[model samples]
Target chain A: MKNFYKIVAVVGLTMTLVPSLLFYFDVIEIGQMKLYMAVGTVLWFSGAIPWLGQKRTQN
Target chain B: MADKSSILKRLDSLYEFDREPVTRNKLQGIGNFLGMYAGEHVAGTEFVIGMLFVAHGVSVRDMFIGGLIGNILAIGSWAFLTAPIAVKVRLSLYWQLKKICGSMLVFIYNIVNALMFCFLAGAMVAVAATAVGIPFGIEMPALSDMLPNSVGWVVTVLGVGTVITAMAILGFDALARFAKVAAPWMFLIFVTAAIAVLPKLGVTPGAGNFWEVARESIWTGVAREGQSQFSFWHVVFFTWLANAAMHLGMSDLTILRYAKKWQYGFSSAVGMFLGHYVAWIASGILYAAANSDAPGVVAYEAIGIAGAICVVIAGWTTANPTLYRAGMALQVASGWSRWKVTLLAGAITTTAAMFPALVMKLLDFVALYGLVLIPMGAVILADFYFIPKLGLQSFYAEKKKIDFNLAAGATWFIMLALALFLNLYFKIELFFLPAPIWILSLGAYLLFSKMYQKNLKLNLT
Candidate 1:
């Protein structure tokens, strides 16, 4: 689960960033870009689940 | 319900070091101030202000030199005025004001302070929502949008507000940490997008004709239709007095109370120089490229989706601390639990986010916020240093068990009225109102206190 969280965090950040860069440089079109970003945002928020759930995490 | 309670529990546990001076051991170094001011000033509002400067028709020379002068004066206010008082007292603005003005007067001030802060943060929430809405196909509000344009806009604001409020509820360290991460990225992005889009605006980097291109196309001294033209003095005053509430008005007593030395207040230069100067210039270029007032869209045009995300995160960094401060003000004023008051303040902010006028009229709104708050700060300053020198008791309310300080109250209203007359009849802009109000209130408070105390013979101490 910890590894899963880590992977989610990394992937979510990349997902959030990659599409934007791709679209800027014209590698991605507007067709599904917004959808991809929506998913990325959700994933990033989910990756922060532990952060939201408890104050016990390492500072 | 379980998640809600957990959130509530988390919020409840977060207590600011209220009521007393922060201990020496707990005092933060200059780096904290550097990071915080940098994060805060180079923020979501930068997008709006940068765009407004362009639309208001400021020339290149006016913006470059004027912003430098204005921001330097702002730094002086923070370093010399606000921080010295903050560190010496080591108390939040609420507690300090209560000691001087008495609880009742401070209560009125708190309500006004919290509402203005909420409205200000609400605009940032709307800015963040613009980005969130982009991917959701939510129609972005125009510069002239006064009402919620669609249900999508409302939901996006709610969504953005939730994240911002939750972070604020986590308290100071968390807020600072978040700023540390976001500030660097946002700064980099601001610079990158500006440079990246310069070519599209017809700046040939090789020919070194960038200044000519900038003068002609980018920072052209021509107002948009229906927009008022602004001059160098206008830009200077706007930049200097934009944060007059925090600096000259003494609201940053809350922030500077955490500093190890008052000199750390000078760290505001980091934010002013980088965000207000460089970032504003960069964003001005971005606006020229995209020809848009919407921050989210302009950023997207410059760097794709990353730009949108920057807008969202930048807004969060700003709105989080603002809403937190508002929540704290209400809590201190109403004697409510911090969590409950924060919840209420957050709700108020989220609702205000539904209206776009808060963002569109931000230049005026910021000015008004500073002007309204400056009088109380002047009163505090006089009570702290001047009254004792004049053979009158300082913290007279605390000594006399008075719930209202008549002198402080009189000083507040008198200055406000004077400000109104100057603004309305004299055609004094909001940016120019703070200076006269600040000077007049200090002298007035001293005179009023001497008379009020002597007449009552309340100087029995």
Candidate 2:
């Protein structure tokens, strides 16, 4: 379960970052970049909240 | 369900080790310190400060080089000055100060410290309010605006302040959790916004004209109308002086006290390089693209709604901890419950948030905050190291059960006077005064302590 959420977080973060990079290279429209970022924000929050809310293995 | 009293007690203990040294078992690792400094530094103020660097006309070369050197000095101060003392003493700044300065003086210091924290938090609230106001068509305050400009502005500020204060009163755990998630995302948002806007600013990745465009349009080295000019030295000093209160003024004693070793102080580099250096540069780029000093306007222009939300969350995260610290300081002075004092702090912060000058003049305000608090840090340093070497008693007030250490009090006041003299008479900028004033504070404290201890010995005999 933790791994699942971790993967979700990774994908969400990648979504957030990649669109901007693509946009910079003229691969994605600004509109699509914003849309991807917005979705990534939601996914990232859902995954990260539960993942980080748990106790850490180390301090 | 737990009753109200139990809940309040739980909330009160959420932040432990206020009046006592952190226990050995509770010592945090370097990872914790790294995450903390990294998260805490990339905050709402970064948006304002980064943009202000552009408005003040800092050339790209000067800002890059000077900021690099300044950040290095800041990290050194934390590692060498603040952390070692914190590791050895393992006491909060307030507790250590009470012993050295005595309870009466600490009480006075607490009031000043708490008020400064309130004003600083108020500025963050104002930044958040700008973002919150955007969708509602509320007019943003001009850079020159000092007073509350509109009913919408007042309403927005109050609304933002209330949410931040309420979250602060709830406890640190929730805020910590939120911050952990928000920090990375917000930092990325800064990166994304800057990158997305670079093309708009005439900077193409492979064009080999990035520096030319940056120098021509971005860090143009020409001040905006009504803004003060800045050079390499100003950039360097401002970068160093921004967090002088934490490193030089020794306020981080409270935070670093949790670390297992002094070396963990070097973890502050993660914050300096990423938040202060990278984040500042990115936001400066966004500012150049947006051509506005208002955080929300610039952010919204760069990346739309995500940018606005970033502004809001960044502001809230920064203001929450600031208000919490303010309440803690006020609790020491007022003898009230943490939540109760936090409520009072929230009121003060909200009121200050109504005034846009607090945010507009944030650079000067931050410098003033450091100047006011740094003398006590000097006293602590001198008492910890130099006073013992000179055969003068250390922590003299605690040793003698004195209500107020006359020497420490005199040093604080005299430094303030010296700061005033330098600023008015010599026209020295506040950003340039901390180093000289810090050295003067050390000497003044030692001289006064010698006189004080001599009188005390005579009275004892």
Candidate 3:
């Protein structure tokens, strides 16, 4: 269960970071930065919920 | 099994055993310290600090050199002062205080400590929300605005606060794991963001002349309109003392107690240079460009959505651990479940985040907060190192089973009064008070402890 949560967190954060990475590499236009941000937000919240929820249960 | 039983029985015999044991092996290695410090320091305050530098009117030369010197001092304080005591005692600051100052005094001090931490974390949540709100067309609090200023801002802050608060409530393993995962990516993002924007700020790529352009145009060290000028001294002092409460004030004693060696203290250099130096400079450059481009508008508008989002996440990462610590302190004080206290603390911090004044006056707030908490660190130092040499017993309250140890209590009050008097009557800067207050508290604790012990003996005699 712990490993599962960790995996979820890692995937979520990575997805969130993908747009920023693309921006850094000049593959994404400046105008599209918002798209990346929106996607990142979704991934971040999704990743956080499971990990945090499981933690609460364990405690 | 026999040894375990004997140890358990022994612990049951001594009231001290009911409290957690201060085992030496629980101390962490240097890498853990480095990751934790770096992740924390780099994230939240970078946005505010960068803006403040622009506001203060620091010069290019001053910003670079001052930041270098200041961070050195900060790192040194952690390595020399905080880590030594932490490793030696292997006890949380709360547990140590319970012995030295008695339960009643520790309770009061912990409440105040936790509240200050919550407010500070609240400000970080506010910082993060500013970015998160950008995409939703949400309004953010302005520099001069104090109240929520917008319903959107309030909702965003609450949303960010809830996530951060939940992470904090999960305890040490989660905190460490999240920091480790987030820190590396955050560091990369900061570097990449700085690089990505350099050209937009009109610095030529890879040109030998770019350094000159960067110096003159990008981080020109001049204050924006309506902002106070900060020089080399201001930058240096701000950086050095920014975490003064954590290092010199010994708040990290709780964290550092888990370090394997004093050398792990030096690992704070990762945070200092990476977060304080690199991240701060990058964010400052970003903000400067934003301000110049937008003119009379808020700096966030100029940086656009990406910059705003970065600031918000940075703030959240920093706030999460800090609020967690605050919750721990409160839990220790009130004897409430840690999760419950942390959740309550999160709510309080979220509410505090609604007020923008704390975020706007972050520099002043940090300085004042450090001043308030520093005396207790000094007291602990004096009680641990000096009292025994002076023929006074350490943990006098536990020895005598007193509810309130007057000596520790008096020392704390006296030091605070003196600090307040200096700030109010003398009109001294809050930054300068910690040194004098630290010295005074140390002397006061030593003197009071000796006198108190002697008087007690006389009563017995």
C-alpha DockQ of every model: 0.09, 0.56, 0.17
How far off is residue B352 in model 3, in Å? 1.5
Strongest candidate by lDDT:
2
Q: Model 3, which residues run further than 4 Å from truth?
A: A1-59, B1-21, B158-176, B209-222, B291-309, B328-343
Q: What's the lDDT of the predicted structure labeled candidate 1?
A: 0.79
Tens-place lDDT digits, model 2, residues B141-227: 988899999999999999999988988998666776787788999999999999999999888879988899889988999988888
Worst 10 residues of 3 chain B by lDDT: B291-300
lDDT of 1 at B181: 51
TM-scores across all candidates? 0.83, 0.94, 0.81
lDDT of each: 0.79, 0.87, 0.71
Q: How well docked is model 3, in DockQ terms? A: 0.17
TM-score of the A chain in model 2: 0.86
Q: Per-residue error at B9 for model 2, in Å?
A: 18
Clashes of each: 1, 0, 12
Better TM-score candidate (1, 3): 1
Q: Between candidates 2 and 3, which one is better according to lDDT?
A: 2
Flag regions of model 1 displaced more than 4 Å. A1-59, B1-16, B150-152, B162-176, B332-340, B458-461
For model 2, what is the error of residue B433's alpha carbon versus the real structure, in angstroms, after optimal superposition?
Answer: 1.2
lDDT of 2 at B118: 97
Give the alpha carbon lDDT tens digit for every residue of B109-218 in model 3. 76787889899998888777766666687755666676778888778788988888887787555654555455555565565556556556665434556567667775
